[model samples]
Target: MDMSMVWRQWLTRHDRVRDALPAVPLIVIAVAATAVGNSAWHEPHWDKVVWTALSCVPLVVRSRWPLQVALFTLAGDLTLMTVVSHTSPTPAACLVAVYTLALLGDRRTAWIVGFVAAVTIAGVYSATHADSVVGGAGLVRFDFALGATVLGRTVRSRRDNLAAAKARAERAERTREEEARRRVTEERVRIARDLHDIVAHHITLVNAQAGVAHHLMRDNPEQAYQALAHIKDNSRAALDELRATVGLLRQPDDTPGSRAPVPRLSDLDNLADGFRASGLDVRVTRTGTPSPVASSTELTAYRIVQEALTNTHKHGSATRAAVVVDYGAKGLRVTVTDDGRPGVPKGAGTGHGLIGMHERAAAVGGTVSAGPRAEGGFQVVAELPISPRSRLTPA
Candidate 1:
C-alpha cells in the first residue's frame, strides 16, 4: 500500500525497464557533451556521438553479463581516446558497468575486475592526455571507479542484512506458534484427567447406593428411603462437582468467584464421609500443625486422596480405611490404608485412576506409591513438597 513499496514492486516486475534506466541518462549526457565539443571546435563529431551511444547501450544488460559489458564499454572508451582522438571526461558508461559488476558478482571477482578497470582506464587516459600520473584527470577517473565499487558493495551488504533479519523474524513466529500448541495439548490432558476423577468417584457411589435401595425396598421401606436419600445427595454432589470442573474452561475475563471452589486438604473429611455413606468405614487423622500451601499444591494433594479412596471403594473388599496426614518440616505426607483383601489384580481395569494419581503428584513435584500391604491389606501413600519449585495451574 505504501507508494515507495508499490514503485519498487513495479520496477522489480519489469527487469528490462529497470536495467535501461541508467543507460538513458548516460547516453543523453555523453551525446550532448560530444555535440558541444564538436561545435566549439568548428567541426562535426558524428563518430564521437555514435561511439558514445554504442558504449552506453550495453548498460541495459550490465546486470546479466557485467564482466563482458565492462570490457565492451572499456573498448569503446579506448577507441574514442586513441583512434578518434576524442575523449570524454566522465566515461559514464564504463563507471556504470564497473558498479554493476561489484553489485552482482562475488567479492573476489568484483575487486579483481574493479582494480583492473581503474588502472587500465586511468593509464590510457593519462597516456593520451599527457597528464601527470598522480595529480591529473587520470587520478580523478581512478577515484570515481573506486567510489562506484564501494557504493555498490555497500548496497549489496544492506540487502543481505535485510534478508537475514526477515528470515529470523519468520523463524521466531513459528516457534511461538509451536509453543502455543504445546500448551494447549497439556491443558487438554489436565482437563481430561479432572473429568475422569470427578465422574468415576461419584458414579461408583451412586451405583452402590442404588443397589442398597433396590434390595431394601421389599422388606424395609424406611431403610430404603434412607438409601434413596443418599443416592439423591450423591447425584447432586456429582452434578455440582462436574459443573465446577467444566467451569475451568470458561473465559479468563470472567469473575474469579464465578467458578466453584476447588477441593483442598480441608475438604478431606467431607470426601471420607462420601465414601462412608457408600458403606466403607473411613477415618482421617492428622499430625503436626497444618500449614498453608499454594493452591495448586493443595489441589494436587486433594485429588490424590480422592482418587485413592475411590479405588478402595470400587475395587477393594475393605470395610474400614484409615487416612493419615503429617505436616512435617520438609513436606506433607498423606497415607490411606484399608483393612480389606485386594480384590482386583495388579495392573487391572483401565488403570487410569492410578495413573492420574501419579501424574497429579508429579505435577506438584511429589510421588505416589500404591501396593498390597505386607500385613494383609492395601495402602496408597503420597509425599508432596510443601513448596514445589513448579506446579501446573488447574484448568
Candidate 2:
C-alpha cells in the first residue's frame, strides 16, 4: 500500500537475494576498473570484458559455498593474466571470495585455503610478470588476500564470544528456576510439619478428655462437666493454631484472616499442660537462663518438644514424658525422653513426624539425635546455635 511498506515486504520475502545485495557494488567496481585498465593498457576490449565477467560472476554464489567460489574465481583470474597478458579488476573479485571463505569456513580449512591461494597467485604472477600488463600489481593482490583473511578471522572470533555469552545466560536462568523450586518444596514440607504437630497434639487431648467424660457421666458429673469444658477449650485452641498455620500459605494482601503469632519456647509450658490434662504426666526442666533467640528458632524448639511429646503420647505406652532445655554457651540444647516400652505404639503412623523434626532442625544449622534409649524408652535431642549479634539485637 505504501512505498516503504512494499519495500520492507519485498526484502523480508527475498532473504537470500537481500544477503547478495553487497556483491552488487563489488561487481560494478570490478567491471568498471577492468574496463579502465584495458583502455589504459590498449588491451583487446572484448577479451578484458570476458575475463572480468568470469572473475566477478562467481561472487554471486560466494555466500553459499565460499571456499569453492573463492577457488573458482582465483583460477579464472590467474588464467586471464597468464594466457592473455590482461590487466583487469579480477583481483578484487578474488579478494571478496577469500574474505567470505575465511569468515564462513572452519578455522583450519580457512587457514589452509588462504595460504594456498596466496602462494598460487604470487607464483602465477612471478611466472607471467615479464609479459603480463598486471604483473606490477602482484604484491597488492597478495596483500588484499591476507587482509581479508585477517578481517574475517576477527569477525568469527566476535561471533564465537557472543554465542558463549548467550549460552551462559541461559544456564544461569535455569539455575535460578531450580533454586526457586527447591525453596517452594521446602516451604511445603514445613507447612505439613506444622499442620501435623498442631492437629496431633490437640486431637490426642480431646480424645482422652472425651473418654474421661464418657466414663464419668453418671458417677462424677462435676468431673464430666470439667472434661467437656476441657474438650471445648482444646478444640478452640486447635482451631486457632490451625488457622495460623494455614495463613502462612496466603499472600500478604489476601486477608481472610491475618497470620496469628507462631508458638514460641514460652508456649511450651502451656503445651505440656494440655498433655497433663490428657492424663500423661509431662515434666519440663530448664538448665540455664533462657537466652534471646530468633523467632524461627524459638518456634522450632517448641515444635520439637511438641512433636516428641505427641509421639510419646500417641505412639508409645508412656505414662510420663520429660522435656529438658539447656541454654549452653554454644547454643540451646533440647532433650525429650519417655519411660515407655521400647516398641511401636498402638496406632503409629508414617514416620514423617521424625523426619520432619530432623528437617526442621537442619534448616537452622542444628542437629537432632533420636532413637530408643539404652535404659527403657525413646529419646530425642536437638542443639540449635544462637548468633551473638542476634542475641544482642532486636528483630
Q: Using lDDT as the measure, which candidate wins? A: 1
lDDT of 2 by residue, 92-154 (tens): 567777888888888888888777777677667766664242455766666667888888888
Question: Across residues 229-348, which tens digit of lDDT does each residue of candidate 1 receive?
Answer: 988888987788888877878888877675678888899999888888889999999999888877877888888888888888887777889999999887999999988754544334
Clashing residue pairs for model 2 = none
User: What's model 1's lDDT at 339?
Assistant: 85
Model 1 CA deviation exceeding 4 Å by range: 1-17, 38-46, 49-85, 315-319, 339-343, 346-348, 371-378
Tell me each candidate's TM-score. 0.84, 0.79
* Residue 135, model 1: Cα distance from true site in angstroms: 3.1
Candidate 2: RMSD over Cα atoms?
5.0
Q: What is the lDDT of candidate 2?
A: 0.78
Q: How much does candidate 2 score in TM-score? A: 0.79
How close is each model in CA RMSD to the real structure?
A: 3.4, 5.0
